[model samples]
Target: MRVAFNVIDETIWFIDRPHEPWTVQAEARAAGRLDDERLRLAVRSALARHPMARARQAPWRFWQPGFAWEIMEEPQVDALSIVDCPDDAALARIRSDLYGHPVPLATSPPLRVRLAHHAAGDVVLLGVNHAASDGLGTLRLLASIVRGYAGAPDPVPDVDPLAVRDLRTPLALDGLPGRIRHAAALVTELRRPKARIAPERAGDGPGYGFHLVRLDAGDTPALGSRRPPGATVNDVLLAALHLAIAEWNAEHGAPCERIGVMMPVNLRPPERRNEVVGNFSSFVTVATDPEDRGRPETTVAAVTAQSRRVKAGGPPGALVDVLATPLPRPLLLKEVTWGLLPFVLERGLDTAVLSNLGRLGEPLSFGADAGDVAEVWFSPPARMPVGLALGAVTIGRWLHLSFRYRHPLFDPGAAARFATRYVGALDRLAA
Candidate 1:
């Protein structure tokens, strides 16, 4: 079976570089040990259930309209590994090294699952190429694996690959006038000024550097209680991020320009949720007044209004519109994308990104032996230009926050500092 790349997938594919790999990481911390062989077999079974994920890029020919994924019977290489991580330090080092390497596109599965067994418990890290799927899709894949490991039945559902890749939004543009309005909105967004964290001169090299923070389960409710009326937990977090960037930049002596955030809006309708396991998301660029940055309440209010407006306006159709545009071949699109990235970064790209997966709705279980997952953390790739990313998820009562930053954009120490500042910013909102 073969499936052509969708516009979003192609964008993720072409923008990928050796230094900046487009990927998503999801970590599950289980309370008990996992049998290596059982885990491997379970993952293999899950791969069979999700054939699209167990696929690699087909060799492209000059006459081909676009790149396609060649579905394989099994992973070309073993996708699971068992690492003996004795302590926190060892686990951190091993994880850093593992994440530095991109999941190979030419290899079947285009993903990796590693079990880092620490003295306390076992932590499983699942990394997937963004071109293959988004964070939510990765979660779905994880859920399938967990079910298989638990001796549960996970029957493969019949899915039409083409229909799943359809770029039409739920609130799609209706006609030529709607498209014209979309174009006008796009132009306005492009003209807006954006701010970014200044890249430091000192850094080890190019790779993803991240810091993890957990909002205490007891205090998680405060995230909701503190929000203004009609503002969701997501809206509050987005507001906190805007303030965090403004404050971080000011503390570092960077200019106080307009702060913009690119938020991924999940477009997977409930009806087709199980059928699609790829990038089914559009973006809405959120920004607020510079004056409101210092006032947490005001900032939250502003962000809340903006969020509501965009949600009411309709599901964004920018990516779908791009697909509608007549463009060049894959080679030319790659070149044009690369050439324009710098200009886009300075002018159009958001200052940072906040992807809130809300909560893992169902518990991830591995029968009794491996035990139920205690916690889950997800970190989206921090591609450059917009080098800073904040990925959040909820499992049980704890809220996991992953701060992923590019190497040159922020060293480990700086990344940690910024994360601390963000926590403090969130706390202020609660107060």
Candidate 2:
């Protein structure tokens, strides 16, 4: 637990920019709920195996090389336990509570859980601080806790970790032209104007709206076959999202001719994505034009083509040259914090961030406590500078989608309506 923050971790912290409660909140809905004590104890045990989970900020001298996460012990397991809430306010309560709880740097553990009971079953909200971990890391932690709570003895991986290969340098190839092209593309992107964000409605607060909807089994797999024969489900979803945003904007009188789509691709090497527990992902923006929204086949083709081009050019994070730097910790922080992001997004950018976590290979179970998970919804951070974010995951035949957006950029009811439009867009494409 005494590891120093990596370049990516420091970048995430700087992006958090004042940590206005930066968190990635998710909901796991299951048919049966685990007892509070059982869930709490399971989390406590899981934390023990992953000391980084309970790592807190410790004192460091200015020239101590890098910032380290110091392991800290907790007084009570229930500190990260669950709470029951009425069915009516379940979603609202979960978002409100999770959004407000940013595991401060000095805090022991940057994660929390809350359970809400409905007539159907339970919705467990897992909130994790982004600076400490990403959405996948949080999901991995939850999976381990569920396994532990289910009475699986020694749920932690038994093997020694693979030798630490630099995550960004996993591939060794000279693509100088590609790198130059990427740099030029980014410069062009920053100079070009973007689409307008959704207009705000009366009473929209500073908080983001959360909406989750499930696609039936019939619709889920169909997404894999939309028009383009080899296009993945993610490509289809991203295409559909383009249409949904355009439609939503048109309906609201703020029609956008072209929309920017940002998808966070897991940058962890093929073998280490599961082993690593941190923010190891980079943004991949696919092309979206106003014309594609009107023609379903063209939209899929455009998305599939653009996705292929981006991947062939480089892995998700091929252009982040920070991995090559060996500078003083303080100077590195100041450079990334002060020089990079603000130069690109000084004016808010109207964009959609879609993170497709796909599925857990197997259904999630909480052993003797909570039964198999019924539904799962995950959403990446909906930070400023971006207008909309969508997270998608499939559990069994159900494809659960969650739309996250903050105010002024989106009205309180915007997420719900956007989701409805998204479903409609998916249906059109799946047909």
Candidate 3:
């Protein structure tokens, strides 16, 4: 079956540059190496279960109506590989290369899977084109892969992609009027002056630089304990992020007037909960006024209010309604890139993007003989201006964080230093 690309997919596809491809990645550290043949069969089985993830972009010319996708029975290109890593350094190098490379759309099943075998442990990495699916969707696919490896059945039945996309956001709106009103409110709020991370150096080059950190199960209680009366763990983490950015900027002699975080909200309704092949997300910009800066308690309080408003169908949901409008592809792409996002990006309304994937929900097991997953983490692409993307996910009780930064905006050393600051901020919150 052939499915048409939705507006969100169209926008992502239009702006996908070779230098900074829109990609989402997940990595799992396991106890032992996996069987190559079994792993390959598992990936193929997973793709078959989720047909939309197996789609290949259909060819189009300027004269065509719009771009569409053709689902294939099997992958046209080889999608999984097993690499031997004699040491930790070799494993690290493999990770950088996998995350840096973009999945080709011309091929069926736009996903890459690599297993690195190291003496200490084995690691499984999955990278999918963001144009194909968001972080959560990637996780669902990964879970299916693990299930297939364990001789489980298909996780879900195939559904219409457009139907899933329609259920995205603005769940409370009456119609066009409510959409326009909320969208305008969001734009007005974003028009205010905002602060951006002052780069440690200069350059916008190809590839992503990333660092990973794990918080043991013992620290999970501390992370969940001290939230304000109604604040969730996410609110606390958001607060910690804002505080870290402020202090890092202060120590480096940069002014932080206002800090903003572009957070992606999942919009799948209960009926469509099992569907996991498309991007069903909307972005909400959570910001801190100057008065709320420099203190963890104050920042948490402020973030809690804003994020609460967002949950209640506030300003951040504007894009959900706006993008769903039925307009021609070329005009829609131009307006989103040149009109809407240009204003937001130029004003620094979004300093960074934080995607908290919450939890894996279930453990990943590759049968009794294969390695068992010890830890897992994911990272979204670090596109410039908002040059950093911070991701958090939990396995059992342990929290795993990934810091992905764009090229020269953050060198390896700078990314490490910034990550340290973030950890310290979270520690203060836990304390």
Could you say which candidate leads in TM-score? Answer: 1
Q: Model 1 lDDT vs. the true structure?
A: 0.77
TM-score of candidate 2 on Cα atoms, chains taken together: 0.87
Question: lDDT score of model 2?
Answer: 0.66
Q: Model 1 reaches what TM-score against the true structure?
A: 0.93
Name every residue pair that clashes in candidate 1: none
> How do the predictions measure up, each by TM-score?
0.93, 0.87, 0.92
Point out the worst 10-residue segment of candidate 1 by lDDT: 315-324
lDDT measured at residue 120 in model 3 versus the true structure, 0 to 100 = 68
Q: How much lDDT does each candidate structure score?
A: 0.77, 0.66, 0.77
Across residues 221-327, which tens digit of lDDT does each residue of candidate 1 receive?
43755545677889888988998888888787998588888888777766655345688877777887688776888888888887887677764435445544535
Model 1 misplaced stretches (Cα beyond 4 Å)? 153-162, 169-171, 199-204, 272-275, 316-320
Cα RMSD to the true fold for all candidates: 2.3, 3.3, 2.5
Compose the digit string of candidate 3's lDDT tens values, residues 155-214: 474565545654434344777777777667667657766777878965666878788888
Off by over 4 Å in 2: 17-20, 60-66, 72-78, 153-166, 171-184, 202-204, 220-227, 316-340, 347-350
Candidate 3 clash pair list:
none
Error of 1 at 340 (Å): 2.8
